[model samples]
Every structure is written in structure tokens, then in C-alpha cells.
Target: MQEGVIVKALSGFYYVEDGQTIRMCRARGVFKKKGIIPLVGDKVTYTPIGTREGVIEEILARRVELVRPPIANVDQVLLVFSVKEPELNLWLLDRILVHTERARLPGVILFTKSDLLENGDECQLWVSAYEKLGYPVLMVSSRTGEGIEDVRSLVNGKISVVAGQSGVGKSSLLNQLSPELRLKSAEVSHKHGRGRHTTRHVELLRLASRTYVADSPGFSQLEFGDMEPEELAACFREIFELGQQCLYRGCLHETEEGCAVRPAAQEGRMAPWRYQNYLEFLSELKDMKERRF
Candidate 1:
């Protein structure tokens, strides 16, 4: 049996790369019987049928799994945002970070289109805010090639899910990294100030040994998905740290007496936007929980 990673899923076929060549393969009937769906980025073992075909025999256990785009064994989430042309959406970026934390994965944020940025202080402020939470943030421009090598270094030995809203230079950055990819990219619309959906499916593209990125479709909406209200604080780094200091055992940090988190937010110890986003997410989770009853 040959061991490989599933690079793409189309129709019902899987294309696996075994460090040499890609082979089109189909999963075994038993997998469907077991309610198993092989996704892109899965490390699997398969049996060859002929020169260019094979049958997937077994799927290895995954390190991580995502539901929206449906990928597996991802080491990190690469959050991409643009400085202009459908400008930076910190709200959306924070939302994605919460989901990333919920998935128990590390995330790095990249501000794309650095060339269009006229005010570096605003970018630095954002960078400082997120960096304080232990996330690596970079300002990158595909046109100017600034921070391109840094991005390459960050993802050199990891499997990252490239995600963001459309027209944020997600695909363009990859193209600049390696022109051979030639991934389709669309420009932001002048009318709506949003980008057209350029990526339609999930596929893992190899960059280096053990370095693969799952280029999935751009999306603007993501649900917390089975996450509990009380468990939300743990998804935000600073809030999780401050929860230990709360006098109440189950403090939600909203109007609770002796809540260290609220005071910190009020004192500007944490970025105001982050605390606001946390409250928004917390409220969302509570609403969802209430509706379940």
C-alpha cells in the first residue's frame, strides 16, 4: 500500500499525492458504511489499480478537523484580510479567530494589500492588539512582495487553511508565492466593494515537504456550531486568562461583581474592539443556547 495525502475531492473521486505523483482514487465501500467521508488534506493509505488509478484503503487519524470547508489535519488557520478594496473587517477577522480557537488550532493573521495602506499607524495598532493575544500578525502586499518571505517562513512546515472573504488577495498571495500554482483570482468589484467567489472547492496544494495549504472557498459567515455559552471565554485568550481571577466560579464577565475582565476592558488593558467582539460572540452563543430550548 502507498501512503499519501488527499489533495483534492471532486464528484466522488479523490486525488492523492504520494510525494512522487498524483493518482485518482476512490474510497472503499466500507468507509461509507462507517459514515466516514474522506476530505482534502487527509493522510491516507491506498492501493494502486494501474498506472494512474488507485483505491483508498485506509485513512489515518487527523490532528484537526473543520466543518465549513471540511478539511482535516490542519496545523493552523491563515487569516487573510485586505487593507483596502473591501477594507479590513476586524469583526469578521475576530469571528474567524474565535472559530479557530474553538477548533483548538493556532491562527496567524495577515493584512493583505500593504501597498494601498497610507496610514501605517492604524495597521500597527491592529498588529499590536492581535499580537498581544499571542497571534503572529503580518502586513503583506502581493504586488510589492513585502512580507512575502515572512509568510513563506511562517507556513514553511505547517498545513494551513487559507481563509478569508473573497477579493482579499487570498489566491493572489499564493500565486505570488509560486507562480506555478496559477490559482484563479478575481478583483474586488467597484460597485459593491466586494470580491466575487473565485475558489469553489477544497484542495490541498503542496508548498514544501510536509507543508501544504488547503485553498478553500471564501466565506463571510461562520457559526459557532455546538459551542456552549460558558465555554466561549476559553476561545478568547485574554478573557480565558482573566476568568480565573473572577470571584464567581461561572462568571461570564458581563456585569458580574469582581469580574477582572470587564475592568480590564474598561481600563483599556485589552483592545476595546476585542472585548466588544467577545461580548458580541458571547451574546450570540447565549441566544443560540436559549433558542435550543
Candidate 2:
């Protein structure tokens, strides 16, 4: 048996790479009987059937699982956003951060198209805001090759998922990182102020011997799946740290008397935008919970 990782899934066939070469494989019948659907980034064991084919016999346990793009065992997420185009969507960025936190996966924030920003203050403001929340923020311009080395160093020897909304230069960044990929990218529509869907599937591309990165399709909407309204605060690193100082044991931090978070926001201790987005997410989750019951 050979141990390998599934790099791609297409037409019910899995492409498993075992360092030396990639082999086309099909999962055994036992997996279907057990209601298991193998996904890209899955560590698995398979038996070689012939020169180019194999049968996956066992699937290793996953460390992280994402339902939106259906990937497993992800080590980290690279959240990409453009500094100017379509404008920086802090709310959406926070929502994605919440998703990573719930999945217990670390995330890095990458601001693409930095070359387009006229002044340094624009990038500095965003960098300072998210870095305060304990996330590493990198300013990268695929056109200028700025911070590309930093990005390459971060994803080396790990399973990383690159995600962001349309028109954020996600595909352009990928192509810059790995020129051989030649991933199709589209121009942002000036009229709509958004990018068209260029990446249509989720597939893991081998970067180095042990480094792999999965390119996920760009999306605009994110739902707080299976997340409780009360648990929302814990997802925000800054809010979670400050909640300990609140007078109430279960403070929602929304107009609640003696709420440390609110005061911190008012005093500029925390970014007000992040605080407001937190409230919005909390309310949305509450409504989702009510609809479920």
C-alpha cells in the first residue's frame, strides 16, 4: 500500500500524488457503503492496480473540513482581497475569518493589488486593523511581484486554501506564484464593479515536494453554518480576549450594560467596523437558529 494525498477529484476519479508521481485512482466500494465521499486534500492509502491506476483502500482522518468548497485536512487559509478594486469588504473578510476560526484553522490575510493603492495609508490602515486581531497580514501586488516571496514562504510545505470574493485578483495571484499553473483569470467588469467566475472547481496544485495549495472558486455570500449566536464572540480574536473583562458572564456585547467590548470599541480600543460586523453576524446567526427550529 502507498500513502498519498488526493490532489484532484474529477468524474468520480481521484488523482493521488505520492511525492514521486501522480496516479489516477478510484475509491473502493467499502467507502461508498460507509457514506464516505473522498475529497481533494484527503490523505489516503491506496493499492496499485497497474502502471497508471490504483484503488484507494483507506482514507486518513481529516484535521479540518470545509463544506462550501468541500475540502478536508486543510492546514491554513489564505484570505485574498484587493485593496482598491471593488473596495475592501471588511464585513466579508471578517465573515471568512469567522469560518476559519470555527473550523479551528489558522488564516492569513493577503491584500492583493497593492500597486493600485495611491497612498501607503490605505494599506497601512487595513494591515494594522487585522494584525491587531492576531492575523498576519501581507501586502502583495501580483503585477509588481511585491510580497510574493512572503506568500510563497507561508504556503510552503503545508495544505493551504486560497479564498476570496470575485474581482480580488485571486487567480492573478495564483498565476504569479506558480506561473506554470496558468490559471484562467478574468478582468473585473467596470459596469458591475465585480469579477466574473473564472475558477469553476476546487483542485489542489502541487507547489513543492510537500507543499500543496487548493484554489477555491470565488464566492460572495457566506453563511454561519452550524454556528451558535452566542459563540460568535469567540471567533473574533480581539473580542474573545476582551470578553473576560466584562461584568456579565455571558455578555453579548450589544448594548449590554458593563460590556467591555462596547466600551473598547467606543474608546477606539477595537476597530468599530469589526465590532459592527460582529454584531451583524451575531444577529444573522440568531435568525438562522430560529429558522432551524
Candidate 3:
């Protein structure tokens, strides 16, 4: 059996690339009987049945799994945000970060449309804030090719997934990184300043010998109740560490007396927006628990 990675899955066929060539294969009955659906980015064992055809026999263990635009074994999630045209939304950015943390995948924040921003202070502030929390940040302008090389370096020899709100130039960024993509791009609504969906499905694009990028649909609305309230704090790396100092042993950090997180935010030690988003997530988790019980 030859080992290969699932680059794309459509209809009932999986396109597996084994370094040299890509084969169109179908999952074996064993996997189907076991209710195991192989996703793009999954490593599998398959036997070549024809020159460009094979049968996927076994799926290897996954390092990470994402629900929307389903993918697995992703090394990192590149969160793309635009400085202009569908302005950056801190709430959405935080939601993506929480999702990445929950999946134990590292995050790299990418800011697009830098050229459109006259000063770029707002975008720079966010980049600095996230960088303080140990996340890598890159500013790229697809139109000007600014910072494209840095973004490309991050994708080399790894499987990275790009996600962001519509109109943040996620597809445009992909096109810049790999000119071969030529993915569809949409303009932001002038009246609402929001982008229409351009990416319809999640497919892994092989950029180089070992670099793969999964372009996912732009999420206008994302839910974070998948994790419990107690577990939510862990999603924010810096806050999670500072929260331990709160007087209350099990403090949720919202309206709680002697909350270290609040003080940190007040002292400008932590990004206030990050704390606010955490509280919002905490409230949502509380409501979800109430409904569940």
C-alpha cells in the first residue's frame, strides 16, 4: 500500500497526492462501514488501481479537525483580516483564535489591504497585541504584493488553513501567494461594507513540494459555544495565564470582584478588546449551559 495525502474530496472521490502524482480514489468499504469519512488533509494508505486511480484503505490519525470547511491534520490557521473594505472585526478575530486554540492548532494573524489604510494604526495595534500573546502576524496587500514573501514562508513545509470574514482579501491573498490558484474574488457591498462569499468549498492547494494551504469559506457568523465556560479562558493565551491570579479560585473574570483580568485590561496590560470578547464568549457559554440543563 502506498501512503498519500487527501488534497481534495468531491462527490464520492478523493484526490490523493503521493508526492509524484495525484490519484483519484474512492474510500474503501471498511472505512464507510465504520462511519469514518476521510477529509481533505488526512493522510491515508491506498493501493493504486490504475495509472491515476486508487482505493483509500486506511486513514491515519489526525492532529486537528475543523468543522466548517471540514479539514484535518492542519498545522496552523492563518487568520486573515483586512484593514479596509469590510473593516476588521475584533469579535470575529477573537472567535477564530478561540476555535484555533480549542483545536490545539497554532494561529498566525494576517492583515490584508494595508495599502488602503492611510495610517494603518488600527491594524498595527491588533498585530502588536496578538504578537504579544506569541502569535505571528503578517501584513500583506494582495494588490501591491506587500509581505507576500513572508506569508509564503509561513506556508512552506506545512499544512496551513486560511480563514476570515468575507471581503478581507483571503482569496486575493491566496492568489498572491500562489498565482496558480486564481480563485474567485468578490467586492464588498458599498452600502454595508461586507463581502460576499467567494470560496464555496474547502480544498487543499499544493503550493510547493511540501507546502499545502486549505482555503476555507469566509465566516460571517461563527459560534464559540463548542467549548465550556471554564475551558474558554484557555483559548486566550495571555488572559488564561493572568487569570490564575484572580482572588476567586474559579472566577469567570466578568463582573467578579478582584479579577486580575479586569485589572490587567484597566492597566493596559491586556488588550481590552480581547477581554471584552472573552466575556462575550463566557456569556454565550453560560446561556448554552442553561439551555442544555
Please give the clash total of every predicted structure, in order.
Answer: 0, 0, 0
The residue pairs that clash in candidate 1, if any, are none
Worst 10 residues of 3 by lDDT: 218-227
In candidate 3, clashing pairs total 0
lDDT tens per residue, model 1, 1-293: 98999999999999999888899999999999999999888999999989889999999998877787788888889999998888889899989988888888889999999999885448888888889899999999999999999999999978899888889998999988778889988878999898888887788888878788877773456888788989889888999998899999999999999899999999999888889999998999999999998
How far does residue 197 in candidate 1 sit from its true spot (Å)? Answer: 1.3
Prediction RMSDs, each to the true structure: 1.5, 1.5, 1.7
Superior by lDDT: candidate 2 or candidate 3: 2
Scored by CA lDDT, what does every candidate get?
Answer: 0.89, 0.89, 0.87
Candidate 2 is scored at a TM of 0.95
Which stretches of model 3 miss by more than 4 angstroms?
218-220
lDDT of 2 by residue, 1-293 (tens): 99999999999999999997889999999899999999899999999988788999999998778887788888999999988787888888999999888888899999999888884445787799888778999999999999999999999899998888888998888888889889888889989888987777888888778888887873346777788888999999999999999989899999988899999998999998999999998899989999999
Expressed as tens digits, the lDDT of each residue in 118-205 for candidate 3 is 8536566787898989999988999898999999898999999888888889888888888887888988988989878867777898
lDDT of 3 at 268: 89
Per-residue error at 291 for model 2, in Å?
2.2
